[model samples]
Target: MHAIKIRLSQEELEQLENLAGAGYSLEQIAMYLDVPKNDFIAEFYDLDSFVNYHYKRGLLMVDAAAGLALAANAAGGNITAHQQLEKIRMAQFVEREKKRIIYGQETP
Candidate 1:
């Protein structure tokens, strides 16, 4: 079986970038684009990277706003924000520990 070639219009590209920025999975984006997920994956070269570029671009704006909010909350002594930040840090530490154990390294 031969692979199908899909050409996206400028509007479609914009829609794709929007959907990806909204944290839609590849499968979800494929569905929105009315294409089979496997076919979309087969046709697109470096699909994840392409989507991630758009996603990160969108996140840049959000990150800036979030940073401002975080700073404001920190300044106001918001315990909830501090706790949430600590929770995120602990989660990251746990993930790193899991990776280290999986790679046969000692977890400090």
Candidate 2:
């Protein structure tokens, strides 16, 4: 299958930067740039991809923010809502499994 080219232009990049600075969501920027999110959209589902893309492109704090957002969503909460649900999940899981002297669940 031929790969679909979805490149960001200088103007689009500038707009994205402006949106980010204005605290817009990734979905909003992507939508404005004509990048659709769907079941077949790999980059959209992979939060690290967005984080790394912004990080390597010199957008400070975006990567970590994206990471935290993804982690929060994975723990069953609104994505990008600034909640520490992922950390809480990890802490709870650790507390339950770590002290089980002989029944420690094997982390797969």
The C-alpha stretches of model 2 lying farther than 4 A from their native spots are: 1-5, 38-108
Residue 13 displacement (Å), model 2: 1.1
Candidate 2: tens digits of C-alpha lDDT, residues 1-108: 224335566676666666665676667667777776342144434545442254234343554566666775766656544345556557767776776645765653
Question: Against the hidden reference, what TM-scores do the models get?
Answer: 0.50, 0.35
Which pairs clash inside model 2? none
Q: CA lDDT, every prediction? A: 0.66, 0.56
Compose the digit string of candidate 1's lDDT tens values, residues 9-32. 667667776776677776887889
Count residue pairs with overlapping backbones in model 2: 0
Error of 2 at 42 (Å): 4.4
Which 10 consecutive positions of candidate 1 have the poorest summed lDDT?
A: 46-55
Instruction: State, as a TM-score between 0 and 1, how close model 1 is to the true structure.
Output: 0.50
TM-score of 2: 0.35
